[model samples]
Target chain A: MKEFQYKNPTRATWAEDYSFLNNDLDNSKLEGDKNKKSNLKVTDLNLYIHQHHILKNVSLEIPDNKITCIIGPSGCGKSTLLKTFNRLIDDTEGIRYDGSIWVDDVDIFDKKTEITDIRKKMGLLSQRPCPLPMSIYDNITFGCKLHGIRNKKRLAEIVEEQLKAVGLWEEVKDRLHAPASKLSIGQQQRLCLARGLAVEPEFILADEATSALDPISSKHIEELFVELKKDYAIILVTHTLRQALRIADHVIFMYLGKVIEAGPADEIFNNPKEELTRKYLEGAFS
Target chain B: MNRILKNKIAAGMMFSLTLASISLVVLIGMGLYLKSAPIFKEHSLWELISSADWQPSSGKFGFLPFIGGTLWITGIAVILALPVALLTSIFLSEHSKPYVKKWIFPALDILAGIPSVVYGVWGILLVVPWVSEVLAPHFVEYATGYSTLSGGIVLGVMILPLLISLFVEIFAAVPRDLRDAALSLGATRWQTSKLVILRKTLPGLLAAVMLAISRAFGETIAVLMVCGNIPLLPHSLFDSCYPLPALIANNYGEMLSVPMYESALMLAAFFLFIVVLIFNTSSRAVIYKLERKFQ
Candidate 1:
């Protein structure tokens, strides 16, 4: 796999400074700029399903305006961690969680917190694009309508802006009224991204959003995520190390449902402090 | 050699089964056409269809009154049943808890399995009297204890189980991923149902309603017990009327004594068959379109 060159020259100096650190680096210091508001803060999140611990004492801080990729092998609770951002895990039976996740300084699990409001602040993309069975225009406008955007001109502008953001406007501009199911799988994923962005969410949670797509489509979606990270905080869960390396601004490594290592993407990829992170990144076991 | 003989026997049996079902429909259609031919030959088809008088002894065999009555009863019954069945199905598939579904499903299955005759008796004992004593005098001056409205309400109740079950199946068949996609976008449950689930399952819902309408059209004993079997056009909900099923079921025996009575009865049966055939065919077309759309 090809390594992505860092865009910022200062990041190289920071990586060099952290290169000689022992395996047990202080996690808070490595997170960078503690005074800045974290996009998402997890204090100590422990999740269990029917007495089986799925995630144990996981703590991390996702910086604002960056793509934070959570990478782990199968069944490592990567997807579970992403779902907690939007509270999508609340629907599952026999699941219990201790600790809190705060998004934009608001604890999502607060007793008085409204789930719909929390969900509104985030957009979620699944492994496979699941578009509502409707026209392309309607798919883009569905979230807007739910948020009470009823003006025709505003909806049309939103549709154009969202589709343009995901680079789908030129391809599907002529047939906005066509059924969304008529699109190719790659086009469908882009359309789903457009649909998610239509809500103007402050955060985006993508759970393996490109695994089902072809290589070209995967690249297109990765580029879109990189572009989107400037305005919204994006958290992606991927098992593909190459994908995490290609687009992640920060990388979180998990093993057996524990955060083994987490830091700037270049440092985590070039000089991983934990033995598990090194072995897993060296293609020993995925 | 033994296996070949067994396969041959199996193929022959399957072919015979298919042939038997097709021949049954052919036989009924032929019988209806042949028996009703004399009526059409004696009086012009238009006269029998357009004339209001239906006296058997004097040989007037107009079917206009019965046709009007059939339409009125079936239309009213569908209008009464559709909203109730849809709401019940939505609750069963989406809102109801597991324990609630456990109790409701078996109750509905039992209601569906109950004989239509029991519904007839129940309507006569309960619905008919209630309409007359509670609803009639206040609504109309000359309301009868047995009227078109009573028959419609009875047929509506009788078909509720069929409609509700079909709708439940349709609603449940909507892919879970679609619902998740909508809800994850911050849509309320009602919005998800209306915008996503309802649009996806529309064809199946239409098919269900058409099937229920076909059932209501062919309902016999229950409709007869409550419909008053009056061979006249119903001017109001409180007026007595006769649908085709009740007309045939009530008067088929009289064909043995009266001239041209059997022919008239056979014609009514033929009309009922045609109406049901149209409904079933359209329902099938809708389902086919739905499948093609998905593909």
Candidate 2:
């Protein structure tokens, strides 16, 4: 059965679509040739969730088009830090934060900077594979359709491109109209990735995105992040230090809501560093 | 007793209890069918249901007027209640503060706990006059204080809390992650709710609505008090109509002297029983399928 049909959004509607999918991302095929160098500059950001100081005064710079891995134990505000970039935490009740995350001089926290615009620039993959309750083809095009890509042929092309991008087309091609929740966990995660990619976000924020998958699926995602680092600035929050070591270009070590160490992956993993970082690497408290 | 043997005994006990309940439903259905058999034997079932001539002395029992009235009131109740109930439940489930829900749920519970007789009295005291004096004047030429419009209004109010409670539960059961996925894709809050959460909960919402319809269909006292019991072919909202529940409730106790009348009433009960049975069972099946799918 045909599960999803587009209502041919007019050009005016497309113009007013959520940030219009950033036109430059359409032609961003070459490596190191991205139009904008949007490095997130988090300056002394303090967060309080339900009056609990969840994130201490945290400051860091996330480089453009690189895999930045946030490594820490559970409840260390790694996911919290990741959420602040897109202002997803604003939806949380009793959450108050004073953070100026400048995305290339445009502060995300600024009232003038539309929150949807800031969010459209970044993709999020949460801990679980959450397919929007629709068919496989619909799930992949869910974000794209919202950005007003109404041409049926173009939508089909996008669904094919994204599904193939995450290497899921061959597996799911025959059943495009099937419910996405029917897919296996690994396939569902890849579908989520493809859905996010359809939005053409410059940054991919993955919060333990592979923790729920099998080792093979976990490996598959790890390989994808390394490949996707060329086109998107990939931010990964991982509890597994080995995963951080394997794919991170830059590593951020956080302990109890504070960044204990931040540097190149090799430098942070191999060399002498902060005592807390070393002890964390040594499995002192987990 | 040995622990495993004790566990076996407990399991056997629970299974038997469940079986008994299942069989009891079957038994009730069979009993109604059998009791209503005499009337169907006397006249073809379709002939009896489709004919509007419901004269008792001449052995002519056409039940179309009562069925039409039942459908009319229920249609009104659904149309009035569904939109408001669905919207309020969505608000309660998604947008309202927990404290707001805390007071509202209890208030709804109290509304639900109030007896049907009280609702009928309230309809008689307020809604009937309001329909005749306030609402009907703008639309129709003539309308009695007691009419299908009043019955519908009362039945709609009676089912609102029931519908809202079920709808809220359905919406609340949807995973928060679905909403998270939508918003993360830069969708607006309304878009996320409508496209993702609402779509996911659509089946459950429909099942709840069907359950509400069955409840409205069989509601006797409230509908009877408001609906004028003049078993005529209902032409408009303001026309007096006699629903099946009202017919059986109005005549069953006093008219047992006429065996044919008793048989006719039994058939009406059978019709309601079968219709409600289909609604409840089918809705339950839909809910069960939804549960398995999400799980």
Candidate 3:
């Protein structure tokens, strides 16, 4: 097997070229900025499937421009909440939502709201990387093309820009027209991230995005998220405590379909206000 | 140790049974070749197929009409079925609700279950009249409606259930996540289907079409009844012609009275079997290769 290597390009070089990458905030500046406004506001959100309560009155304020890891045991509705942000799994049979998720001060579940229009605001990285069944270049431009960006030169630039952001351009630059599925699993995940970013969303919702990747690859993704948080609100769903502690600036802990504790990463991990949060953090029940 | 011996015995028996099934196919091929040997000795294979004269009285047995008719009918049938099948499969798999699909799918299965003879009867009653009375007068001077066009229509309808079922399976096998990946990018339902799912399943779809074509080739009773079985070249869709299966069916019982007739019919049967066998095997191979590549 060939050894895989790609440069993690500096943000300074990226910032000079792209308007979106202009924000380069360190920890203190991001923390200062978050206290002013939450990017997403969920109010009295209750979800049910076949008359069984899945999320019970789930309400939280997800901070803007920060990495907020939703960590809890499996089936605790952490993933369900992440999906609720984009209304991804709401179309499943017998699924009913009795809540409002306000993105940009508009209720997303309103009958008048167009689902596709709102979904464009957030790019979701699912548990397993699913590159669209297309060439690598087409995969990046697919989302842009959907939004009606027809200029050939512009599409080419967006493809190169997104790929370089995720450190995939150097590796896949030669094989731009090759099928995206042909890449290594680690590389495919990066390609998917690049694809997600090309759509230019304000928030990136990842549901255990690195769970399917090897250590080096997961580390690669974590580093990408750290760099990306300056410009995009990065919301991650994870069961791994180590990962949550590693990259999360803020943490939202949920258990039994309820938010147990929500605050800064150290505040939740070090001095948890709730006993359940402390126990969960201490590996009481994963 | 005793259980291990029993397990080995069972494995050995299963393996031999598998080998037996393969040998059965070889046996059939050998049987077909041997039965058709007398015809090979009588005429050169090229002269046998390419020549127009098929008179049995003078020992002439050209197969051009039957071969041409089969090709024309099959070509027309596939052209008619491909778009309808693709659209129907897409509708059932992507657009229809579960309840709608639940209702539609069993109907297709029931369509598959009905005998070909029934389809032929229906074709004679409805399609023949429709083509003769309503369609042919505009283009041609006269048509009996018992022509290649009628056979093609009936054959296309007959192959519908199989094509739809295969296409539906192919479309449905694409993971929901891949669709969601496209949908989340703000792509509409049709765009997602066209760019993602349809493109991904092209190889399997090709395999399915090949399988349906083979099935269409060997369809005997339905095609024979409506085709106005005359051993002549079909210059147009409305012209009467005789397909290979129809040729074998109409001539086999009368073959004993004529010397070269039985050999000629056997040769037709042999050629049909070989063509169908090659198509079936190669289509299966394509589908298998596609499965391995995707996985």
User: Best-fitting candidate, measured by DockQ?
Assistant: 1
**Alpha-carbon runs more than 4 Å astray in model 1:** A1-38, A46-53, A94-96, A255-258, A273-275, A284-286, B2-16, B289-295
Task: Select the stronger candidate by TM-score from 1 and 2.
Answer: 2
The lDDT of model 1 is 0.86
| Model 1 chain A: ten consecutive residues of lowest lDDT | A4-13
lDDT of 3 at B111: 93
> Residue A115 of model 2: what lDDT?
77
DockQ of each: 0.54, 0.40, 0.46
lDDT tens digits, residue span B172-210, model 1:
888776877888899877888888888889888998999
Error of 2 at A7 (Å): 51
Tens-digit lDDT track for model 3 on A39-68?
Answer: 588989999988878999888877777788
Report lDDT (Cα) of residue A28, candidate 3. Answer: 40
The list of candidate 2 runs beyond 4 A from truth reads A1-34, A284-286, B284-295
Q: Isolated chain A: TM-score per model?
A: 0.87, 0.86, 0.86
Question: What is the number of residue pairs that collide in model 3?
Answer: 0
- Candidate 1 chain B lowest-lDDT run of ten: B286-295
| lDDT for A256 (candidate 1) | 87
Please say which candidate is ahead in DockQ: 2 or 3.
3
RMSD of each: 4.4, 9.1, 6.6
